[model samples]
Target chain A: MNYGLRRVLPFFALILICGCAAKTMVVLVPDPDGKTGRISVSNQAGSVAIESPNQATTVSSGKPPTPPVAMEKETIAALFSEALSIQPKRPVHFILYFEKDTALTPDSLKQIADIIAAIRERASTDISVVGHTDSVGSREYNMNLSRNRAASVRDILVKQGVDANSITTTSHGKENPLVPTEDNVSEPRNRRVEVVVR
Target chain B: MKAITILVTVTILILGGSVACLAALDYVGIVKTIAGEVVIVRNAQTIKAEANTKLLKGDLVRTGPNGKVGLIFEDDTVVSMGSNSKIMIEQFLFQPAEKKLSFIARIFQGTASFLSGQLAKLAPNLVYIETPQATIGMRGTHLLVKVD
Candidate 1:
């Protein structure tokens, strides 16, 4: 009986410790557009406090906390590291333009090396290729052209050893233009494909 | 003498197993990228940060003037830090099968970006990033924050 009790005691202690353990997980993802953002915190129990170079506040239960506050680039990096215990990874973005009505261009071809290098740096990642077109063609025609452009880029990445399954391709056609223009207009910047590696 | 030696061996094995289990439960994320000068403060010791570095709860990460680093949590969340910044990870718990998740961290100074993953999609409020002056609640897919 003595030996049995000794063995059982450790298991019981383990169960108790596991049941009582409470941990907090924090995740800080950057804005894809690299713009200033805000964060808001409220205390559910005890007191949640925040202190920044510009201001400080303590939030108690049952009262409204401070309003959503915008942060600068340096401030965001510091706060994010503090909360997540890890540094955020820089996101890689690329824009490649298409020729008059096709999904190929000299400038876009030049960007292939940069895109491949970015994807190879990470062990595993997700790639987004969004195709766009100028307002020089009909909506249906533009949509098809944009999709073909995105597919063309995806093919190139896959050929360069990026996993095809990790790539997602979509088309915005003329709906979302980098440089908005009137109908039947040809904007060089608008007819492009944007790639994001995360 | 033989019996005494056997008993001592059994005791050591039991203790070692428990220690290993505890260490396994403490890991929350791993360093995916590091550039320039980055370091981590853990248990009062400062260690240089590098790729594939394992990060635990209660760890403080700081970067120098040219330092930059990236970290990915178990739940696929990504965080990248810029130079001249500091951050503290207070607590992290992710168990998707059981629907249990919570993340809390504080940024003392500097700039950082965050990309939400499974935890935020499963339950957004469970993840919290705090600054010296304000607390950030994520309502979107990506966020860039700076304290000073």
Candidate 2:
């Protein structure tokens, strides 16, 4: 019996050691919209190496040896098939349209309560407020108008107890339209502010 | 007789200690939502999933005919699995300060949606989702994967 136990003990030990040596692998996929994605991997024993398109990296042990590195991708998919775990949290988005040449519409004003409620429900601190405009205005004019709209929404969110630093505001102007229109066209949905709560 | 009992007790204690240590270091994430019936299998043990149920690396998640499950990673990535689905978290590593980011998952069957987070935003090339038929490398912020 003792001899049998000794043989089994060594087998269990071998199993444990092999399991501990499993390496973590990361697979990169480019974004479909022609945007680039980037990633860098380094370890204590090796210098940092960044992955190019359709590349993979392996990290031994669990601890990372250095700080984050950036890479470029066209369509990005980061797959860490080892050494990590995940849970799911659905993100919420709100689109508030503006009146002609104005920052906020009455309909959008009423939606503020809903936006605030959604933000509070998720208890998320990171939020994005992006503004847009119809093609009715000049490029320069639309840019400034979009910025003003986003800033206004950011201010309201701050007043509703969201952290000022957590909200990032940007303007797409007439570049990315929800409803693509000809020049100088008036599309209500095109002139809007989009709020994404992450 | 007394010596034999003591030997057996010591062996049991050692085995239990090893298991406890493994559990302590194996935490990955928690179940954020569940509908219908969902089960998680890890370390050869299966359990019904509920909100806040902890998940570990190399876990197998399955849903019943009308089930759904959602999970959020430490890196803020979200994964939602639909009914009659089976998925495995093959790997995940997110340490921003150290610049370590990777996410890989395999879908055996059913539908799943992935939303990129800080890791994918920072290092897009490190994320991948695999299916029996094909492997998807995500460069976009969100992807919906379905497997028959």
Candidate 3:
């Protein structure tokens, strides 16, 4: 070949080799009737998992567990690897505020209890209580009222078997109205505590 | 004469390059034809998906009424969407060595089973599913997500 042609040929050859080598996983299956059955496993889109058919072998004594087919092992490996990546390091927390309830009713209490139990079952995290109320009465009166509401919730949670230390209580009375409508009217929704777990 | 020869060679190269690029983007895992509705599955019953549209690879898919669609990703990862449920692929990549994948399926209303592959291990957070109330993150191995 001419000198110019020779230079281009190697570059083309290199590109082809790189392209072929980039594909690593190749799925291959065994022939149903082969002398020594061997299957190649790959992560390619069409790989199928094959299980060995059982044969009637009399077993009165202990027998060693048969090893899985190579393809099965490879497939399992791929799954495990993928699972490891998506696993969450820690459970996420959500905050829920009671909007339209002045006093904790039995149904509301039950719902709160259920939510706490659900959170506990799904994740292990601390729950915080931030209580608030709208502008009404005196500042001191509102603060005590908010604190009482928070404590009442905390006590109910404790009765439900949640550790007292796992809970933190704080009150924001007549200070932070979620809607901030500038009237001295008591908005039932604003007089509530938020449950947050993080 | 040399310029003419070079011109002809350049034209051929340009045409060949365009053809190769288009070919690469053409083959997708699953193509939704006729604009089918995605179902939200719950307790094996399929409901309409929140989003109504045709499905492509990585398209959020759920079972339709009384039907379950099983998906096996390019890397042999198996994810089953429950009836009356919701899910999104979020991200998926399947190359051998440099394989990296991220799938986020928001389960707004039901259950799902996730089985991971090698690429998923490389980037765990790449695959995230957001629901109406929570975001489920995958840990190593197998998991069944039930959003009730």
Candidate 4:
């Protein structure tokens, strides 16, 4: 028994060495019917066909194939190159302001309502509405005017079938300006609201 | 007076021409891998790549170096890399206005996992993965990418 075991040791060692030198190629594929399958091919001097439920397929060879590995590396490099091409642009800010007529007329109200409706339509989760005005009358008067403008638009939106709850309002009475002009000059454009959506 | 007018016209033309050329070369922006390096890349089922190659969206990237690659998508989703592995970013598109993002990656070598963000929550199909031979649609919270 000892003599037989010693004779078989060389054969087992040779098999282990050959297996370590073998290279395998695997391809992962999805099943059409949602079942897993695999097919394996060898780079050795032999070809073997396999059918498995898993879609993963592996081809093993008795010796490692330098050419195929080199090719795979090239393919992966191309993919990396392609993924690096798409990028994002810098954010741009565009400001829009509303004007206050000498007195609120039907046309003016309609325009205000239209602007509010547009803002409501475009209001995303991060929407903000800030009302402002030109330095006119008194500080209190300007503040009231700004608040009223914001509230007025909010009211119009509610009447136009918008969710008033989603809208937030703030007043910046004469703090910001579209154009720097003298007081009481009726800077109509400054009596307005700014809407931002992110 | 005529010579002065001609000189002014020539200067305007030169300035305008240069401005136009520079504008043409202006970069909109580039989406690229913030942390990963491409150890292996090929083309159309072929092997071999040109030197100094650049990667773009939809390109598959397999990295080895203890899988230390990292990537940050436009939507702020972060992906950590693995060692002796392959990860392919299948698709990535970030449009903040519509809150739309598309992202996909595949792994072929070692192990990899992903964390979801705007791309995953907004558009589920945007993220995908592949293993030794399987294309995995990312639906689970987290996954392990490995090839046995």
Candidate 5:
């Protein structure tokens, strides 16, 4: 009876070990926009870095992750299909330059229609229109000007039937410039309103 | 002296309450898609999730069997989970202007697809995806994780 019990104990131990094998898995894939990135998986034992697309690693108990191996597309799709299927569409960002102060440039003004279309398409839960200014004025002056710039964009969205509560406006006040310039320099590119719909 | 101490403590309490209220008003993420039974346990309150449900830091998301859900954080980070999944939004501090940024998420069980956002590009090392066994350090990338 003792010998039989020992054999059964070994069998249960084997099951435990196998159950712990690859119990946790991680795979690096390209970002939604197809941009490549890398991930380092680490445990108390050691770490392995994977940059290749579809590379995967299995974390085991009390051991460093196994070396990363490239996983098949089908395998990845099958395992992650549910999560993938529910993936949200990427946020859309738009930059509309200001002609002067708070006025939208002619080309940018014409883009209002397209911007509205994007907001509608996403059924955007929230929208942020941040205003920026070239360093052409006093900091306080630019701050107020930037606020107005952002408010103008928000007004347009609200006028177009977007919920006002869903839109937020911010002013960067020449603090974050697209084209870095010395104070009081009018950089056209730096004077812009950025809108992100998500 | 004791009265002054009590006054100071009361003032701190009031200030803390206001800060919490302000923080609650600022949502860090939104639920973009939900199918089946997905609920968010936030501050110990179970709120049924719907499309566009605002999510706050420290919220725990659990997906029932046959459930699936997706979220997009303020910085465009995306996370989608499958059925029988539990995820915690442990911490999120993004202030691009001040350069204060961190995003950490812990998954207790099930599968998830993660897509990094602005933080991934701005400061990848500050983002982390932690599981019961291992931790994933990212550098502007996407990841799929499963725990069974």
Candidate 6:
């Protein structure tokens, strides 16, 4: 649509559009997961929120951003081709379950090979292993237990030729659970280590 | 007793501030992709940017006429810009353990893309993008911004 306008107009028309473009413009696109999310654009005048994909809003003349309107795909590509071109691959996440205390379940033990393959495929230099536990034991005890669970995974990967420094292990304890359970409830899903390969 | 309590509080505050200063010395992000003449300005010094180069919190990335750069922050936030663009890495604090999460940047000019990362997923309202005429609060979405 914008290309049509430019094709019809001549030289001086370029300068007429705020000396080449609007003072500020924002275009919301679908997230990596293919889900459209909301975007809010605000200025000295007011705020306008848009939820549709490819919606664009521009704050011209400071009277708040005009109502967000759907933008053509070509317009987005023309404006952001370079930026979109250089985007790095999104990170991938892997979950490994544990049996009791610092020991990985049999299936999870086998999953380490898959995690390593992902690391090699992505040439990932940054990896984070976060451990979580079921809502059992004291918070302080669960925190320590979670750290040990994370260390168990980190140590195995380090022994398997992964860089120790590239991996950061943190203990989330029972604070974050896959399945929300009552205090002291034993949930196997909660005892897990999440590895994010980036 | 009151004076002693005040003295202890002041000492703790000073220690906390120094700890934060020490953390700032760590790299907040790394350049994932670089093409042409992308450069980063840190502490008034301009340095050529390359792939895998670490970006500090206060670094300002500026691109030449044909330059483009992509960066992934510690919390997994991604920022990419086209030629003739300037994006300031003003603030990035992602201490999830302590619940201290913030990501802020200012785009001085040109075209750029921003994708909210783990921090925004954790707390969307804390992420922000500042432009010359407007301030945008990012909410776990992707944005294409142009400042002319």
Per-prediction DockQ comes to 0.12, 0.05, 0.01, 0.02, 0.54, 0.47
**Model 5 agreement with the true structure over A11-74: per-residue lDDT tens digits:** 4533443365446788898876787788899989999999889888888767888798767676
TM-score of 4: 0.32
Ranking by lDDT: 5, 6, 1, 2, 3, 4
> Can you tell me which runs of candidate 3 are displaced by over 4 Å?
A1-102, B1-148
TM-score winner among the candidates? 5
The top-ranked prediction according to lDDT is: 5
The DockQ-derived docking category for candidate 6 is acceptable
Model 2 chain A: worst 10 consecutive residues (lDDT sum)? A75-84
Task: Give the runs in model 4 whose Cα sits over 4 Å from its true position.
Answer: A1-198, B1-55, B65-67
Give residue A127's error in model 6 in angstroms: 0.9
Error of 4 at B42 (Å): 8.3
- Residue-by-residue lDDT tens digits, candidate 6, A126-182: 788999999989999999999999999999999999999879898999988989999
- Between prediction 3 and prediction 4, the one with superior lDDT is 3
Q: On DockQ, who's better, 1 or 4? A: 1
DockQ computed for model 6 against the true two-chain complex using alpha carbons: 0.47
Candidate with better DockQ, 4 vs 6: 6
Better of 4 and 6 by lDDT: 6
Tens digits of per-residue lDDT, candidate 4, B1-148, equal: 9999999999999999999976554221122232343353534443222221334454555654532454434443545444555666656665533455666566555544343445556566556554433444443233223343
Candidate 6 per-residue lDDT over residues B1-148, each given as its tens digit: 9999999999999999999986768888888888999999999999999987888989999999999989988888889999999999888999776788898899999899988788888878888888887778888678899899
Across A154-181, the per-residue lDDT of candidate 4 in tens digits comes to 6765676666655556777776667777
Indicate which candidate wins on DockQ. Answer: 5
lDDT of 2 by residue, A1-198 (tens): 697786565445333322444343343444334443544444445433333444434344444422322222311122221111233445567899888665578988999999888877876555779888999879989999888989988998889888897676878888768888899998998989989775
The candidates' interface RMSDs, in order, read 10.0, 11.2, 20.2, 13.5, 1.9, 2.0
Model 2 chain B, TM? 0.83
**In model 2, which runs have C-alpha deviations exceeding 4 angstroms?**
A1-198, B1-23
Q: In order of the candidates, what TM-score does chain B achieve?
A: 0.85, 0.83, 0.57, 0.55, 0.84, 0.83
lDDT of 6 at B103: 89
lDDT of 2 at B35: 79
For candidate 2, the TM-score is 0.43
